[model samples]
Target: MRIPIGRFTVPPEQPVVEEKTPSPSDKEAGVVSEQHPSDHESDNDAISSDAQAGVKKIEATTKVWSKSHLIAAYIGIWIIYFVDAMQQGTGTLLTPYVTSSFQEHSLTATTSVFSSLIGGISKLTLAKILDIWGRPQGYMITVLLMTVGLIMMAACQNVQTYAAAQVFYWVGYNGISYTLSVFIADTSSLKNRGFMLAFVSSPYIATVWITGPMAQSLLQGIGFRWGFGIFSIITPIMCLPLFFLFTYNYQKAKKQGLVVIEKSGRTFWQSVVHYFWEFDVICLILLSGGFALFLLPFSIYSYQAYGWRDPLTICLIIFGGLLLIGAFVWEAYFAPVQFLPWSLLRDRTVMGACCLAAILFVEYYIWNSYFTSWLQVVLNLNVTQTGYVSNIYSIGSCFFSFFVGIAIRWTGRFKWIAVYFGVPLTILSIGLLIHFRQPDTHLGYIIMCEIFYAFAGGALVICEQIAVMAAAAHQHVAVVLAMEGMFSSVGGAIGSSIAAGIWTGVFPVKLAEYLPAESQGDLASIYGDINVQLSYPIGSPTRTAIMDAYGEAQKWMLVGATAITGLAIICVVAWRDIKVKDFKQVKGLVA
Candidate 1:
């Protein structure tokens, strides 16, 4: 039987354009080609030049809607950013809610259910839809999904209902964001792509910074449902401007016959299969695995295990936003096609960079989630102190990641830098986590740890991003990026789940064993209560058990981070080196 591989294939060549010059008699057709010696392209170009030369076009004569249209575009982008930020920022919160709703659920069960429902199916389905439908249409469908899902979540009466709605909403929204990034890539020019993409990321930063206060205020004033209800209002409101931008772009492209996409006429399943067959497929798979491993544990740590002051969560989130924004800019402008490219995987220099980035991400999750909690819970610092100490990591990452891009450009040899600095730093940082696993660390010691890890990890991440894009062929860059994002998301989910499960399952069993016979009745009663309002406190056996469990969990994360980095090192080893030839030379070689 012949295999039916239905997938969109990358264009084999740029569209062949045939230039024609009109004869003098047919001058009305307007010769716009450079081959025509005349300065005038058309009566329209002449008129456009003449009108603008004499005077600044008066405001009254200019298009009135341009300003409105631009405003709408900005707002539309903000809305997308807002929802995206929340989906990520609120991930930790969601697991606990799911756990509570399903009383007998293990962390693995909850995470697996969530990953399959939200990450796996949602991403795959939405990706297909994005390919078939234009960005605007896909975005509209996403908005509809989120709106309906949020409404359902607000009204949810049980665990299964909530999970189903979350899956529906996440699939649409997540897919739309990925498609939007591709859309942004297409719309932007090379010179400004980096800055423009960074501009788009501003909302993620703003949301992280602002949502803490907003969530706290709402929770205090109205309660959980009302807080979510008020937040949900922002979703539909954000879509109004998107409606205008998407509609305008779609219509303009349609009129110009510029909206044509290469449709290979492959069946849907074939397309997915073809997607996986490409070398870019491995990047996606690995990155997703890394992300799931890291994020799953981190998400559950905040609420389920640590009960951190809310502001701390917010600050860490904002820091992540900043680092990601920097990464976005680096990916867009400096190394648009290199950072996560298939070509990069072929080059040892660039592969080292990509490996470094994955390792940095793992370090970021481990230090931010576990290390900070260790300082607060074990060291006994107040929330304010922990917040300040933790923010130090972000500060270090922000400064170094920005400069590292320029440094790579200055040095010209990224391979030497990555192998010498990045690989070692990653190994060392993981070592720090394992070595510094004391029961009660001092504040100054914690600050020193943050400064070292953040600076090294941050710089490595920036280099890796640049390396991936810088090494890839131009057309394959976007595919590489999409793969990177998929993995990052998956890693995060995995990290949070691992952390939560270790604490909840292992520690609880230990607690049952550790309690004295006389106090056992009291402990069992306390644990059994299960109500939000517990009458007992004072370092009860239950609380101690929870803390000890989490402390042990931290050790496991250190081991996992070290192991993952080891794999990254192997991937680096797999990478072969290629000389950096000019784009024209590279293109000729590929051809």
Candidate 2:
């Protein structure tokens, strides 16, 4: 006797007994056959053939709509990028003015802390929301949060309110960016994903140039309120098309039975409970609180009376560390549904890509935290000049990202690019930056360093994204990418905190050491006021001393950045050379 096993028919030893007979209802529902044994074998063969035909029909329908919907989705994505670039560029250029208005130079680091904390939490939250609820809902919530933040900032009368508003804005900004990346991953094959990401991001290059100058003019002319207010309106309008596109496609998918609506005959409260279980809300709270408590102390310690030795700081760090440990244990062994997929830990490529992203960001933000202020004080560049010089990085990022996208599309390889171009150029650029930190360094040299650093950094971004996506299973793409973003955000926060700590710890002391004894009393006043530091005449002893202190502090920061970039090279080297191919093919093999 022969028994069917998938496509093959296997011969069994001895006579095969007939299984239990189907009831009348089973026959009516087409679940089981009520026929002679020989007839039942033919019926089973026909059923299998019908199922295969149905699968092919569904695939044909999916291919047809996938192409059309993808084109519409890409158009919506481009519009979102245009609005996002304008908002980011304007906010970045206006940072100095915002901090100065609050009479705290260290507000730069403080704001970064706020952004990182909120951004990290938001990414973790939105990852679950996106994977569970779908992209359209996640996108709508992100835009709504950002709009509210912008409105609050525009209406803010105090520094407290402004800082509070930034929480919402950063969360929204990070969520929107992460959602867009997931969208690209969902629509494009691995072969073209890098190109698609770069193509969408290319708009930012042009937008940055315009918005940087525009932000300066807005701050100098109309004011910060109008700058924030105008974007609040533009963001929602630009994002509307995306909302419509996603909703339309989602409904269409449901109608086609491409998506099955999981229905549970549960009450509203039970539904909420189900969602909480699925999203692992407890783990999210523990993780977010733990990170905020531990990391935020570094940013604020310099302002405390006892600094790092403060009792409050000590308690925060201790409790935060404990909570983080608890969260890890829960996710690893106890949770029924784990948030962090521990299985990915065994995959060298995924972990390597994530670490590469995190380490590189840490390196970049070390010098980045104070580079603007360094230019103003040490190099004597005005706001407009500083904006132009600082924005050279964006110029480099824009062009290189576009070209790298094309390169990946053409060459079909990204690992060697990371090893040969991305890692080396970043190391070289940071080294040059350290060498050029002196007050007498030429403006051209600084600009060259910015260009080289940003261009190389752009290549790394493209490469890491491709590497991670290639290594992850298709269904897990969104969460895996979110994990990469989460690590990078945490790194940025840590880097900013470390940079602030070093600057605050060193700058005032260096200023005191460099200044004449008689003028040392003015140290507190100078730290409090940017204008006061700029008040001294050219080549004056006071101005020279301030510049010297800035140069020294920045040199240490760049040195730290250089070391981190070297570590990033090790991460790039350790990354597995996973070949980029269509995930559909990978899925086929697994199936």
Candidate 3:
């Protein structure tokens, strides 16, 4: 009987005529079906086993880098950072020689132009080069640029020639600095990024501190050619290991198909535009601008205006640099961004942070470039001892940076920190500088002032970074950072130029005024040996008396710092009461 189920009824006689099934040996042999629960269970087990085996194979075949490799990468980054420091530190030593040999400050300006070109211009151009050519090639190219620059510097006789050399030097400098940062970011996980970053920074600090005195010693003893030549040789040797490191990384990336750009799309314009819209690019510009602005008066004026011959100036600059770096990270991670669809700089908090950073950096630069030089020029400290004493700023900055980080974490608001610690210390630093007029004033007082300034500067740096980041929504952090750098650089360049103009303009007029009218023209010859003013026995009384006339120039620097910092306070005030925006809700606007 047939059983009927639903729509159609089964016919009772449908299977009455049964046909014979085909034999197994036949071409159309029938297949057998296994219906046992055990067969299904066994098949499932086999599939699971195959998956586990695949996972095991992956675990076993995947290469985990050795500790030695990790250490090598770390050290390699450190060396890259170290080279940039050495360039700056050694350049500080070479400045006097370059100025004297060229007999023109304009040549020095040319060198500055070259330096800026490599740093700002090249960074824009090379970003794409890195993407297309890969990081290894970019790194190697940078090493070559640096090597060529140093070699040219060693061989320079004229100002133009030396300035030309700076182009190459700066190219190398920007290349390595930018590429290494990219490499680190690519290789490290987010959790350990902070430590790795710190590892890179530590070398910068350590090298800067040591390079100054060492560079100075080399300049004084073996002369500039050999001193700078050594760097040329060392740069390539130091970069050799990087060749292997970068190659390994590139090969790995190739295998993974991680390279984004191809050689066909490579062009200077394309490279620049590639990074223009990137968040990190903006951040780099902003931070660099802040740094540049801070550096302006000091970098341009210290050697010429105050006749500073101390290495400590550089050390102090690095102190602030390291502190601000930490502050930047905290800000970028924690702060919000504004104008999410466009720019990152419109955020008030970030603007305030930039302002404060600008203030502190400018103040620090003044001391680094001018005060120490004034101490030696006006107070007459010997070179050896003065270099050691320059560490006062470093001592103060290092101590305070640690404290400021804690203060921000403890207190949610950054306003009080800016007002209470930031502005007051900056004002007081200027005050201390103004009062530091007496030739016989104790060095201890100066050191104390520097310490105080460093403390204040540290607080300001942290506050500004936090505020700026807070001001912007999260998506624009990198853009804000780049803007900060660009502004800082412009500010610094202008400040330094002003300082140079002031010194070159003032010193000669004062010297001329104190000299006899007939001897005024002849006194110009004595400018190369400005120490003659301190030691009348070495030259003439007219130069000494003329130098004495400008005993008040040092005090003017204090007034300038005070004025700049006052402007900074106004920026700080403007920065207050701004609300930070949340970026997560606007993620589509970000990219």
Ordered by TM-score, highest first, the candidates read 2, 3, 1
Look at candidate 3 and tell me the lDDT of residue 493. Answer: 45
Stretches of model 2 off by over 4 angstroms after superposition? 1-69, 260-262, 516-521, 581-591
> TM-score of each candidate?
0.60, 0.85, 0.63
List the candidate 1 regions with Cα displacement exceeding 4 Å: 1-79, 90-109, 116-132, 159-162, 169-173, 187-209, 218-221, 239-243, 257-401, 404-423, 435-439, 443-475, 493-497, 513-519, 522-545, 572-591
**Global local distance difference test of model 1:** 0.45
lDDT of 3 by residue, 1-591 (tens): 111111221211111111111111111111111121222343111111111111111111112233455457667777767776666555654555565565553223335532552354345335434432345666788889988988988899987788778768866775676566555533443223323444464443455366557756875788778877888988888888967864564345335432222233446665455434322444444444445443443534434434433445454456546645743763456323211222334445555666565555554444344343455455565443444455545445544655665454445456777777778887887687678654546777887777777778666655665455444422222334434443343444444444444555455566667776666666655444434444453234663454454455555655666778787777777665422221121100000
Per-residue CA lDDT of model 1 for 1-591, tens digit only, reads: 111111222222222111111111111112111122232233221112211111111111111224344445545675677666654444333333344444522332344334432453244334333432334555677777776766666677666676666665665465556555545443332222323344454454444444444444443465445544654687777666766655664454334332223445667676566444422344334333433333433344434434334555445545545544554454445532223333324455444544444454544454344444444445554333544454555456555654554454355434454566656676776667666665544556656766776666555554454344444433333344444444544444444455454545454465467555655665444332222112224266544553454456677767777776766665555433322222210111010
lDDT of 2 by residue, 1-591 (tens): 111111122212111111121111111111111121222243221111222121222222223244445566677788788888878777876766676677776667667765676676567568666654566668789999899989988888766777778878988888898988877775565667777787778777777567757876896789988999999999999998877766665455456444343344667776677667666788887887888788778767878889999999888899989889999999877776777766664566677888888888787778888777777788888766777777777767767987887687677678889999998999999999888978889998998888898899889999998877776644456667887888888888778877887788788888988997777888887775576777876598998899898888888989998988788777778776655542231110010
Candidate 1 minimal-lDDT segment of 10 residues: 52-61
Q: How accurate is candidate 3 locally (lDDT)?
A: 0.50
Ranked by lDDT from best down, the candidates are 2, 3, 1
User: Candidate 2 or 3, higher lDDT?
Assistant: 2
Off by over 4 Å in 3: 1-72, 104-145, 167-199, 203-209, 239-247, 253-342, 355-373, 390-419, 437-440, 459-480, 516-521, 528-550, 572-591
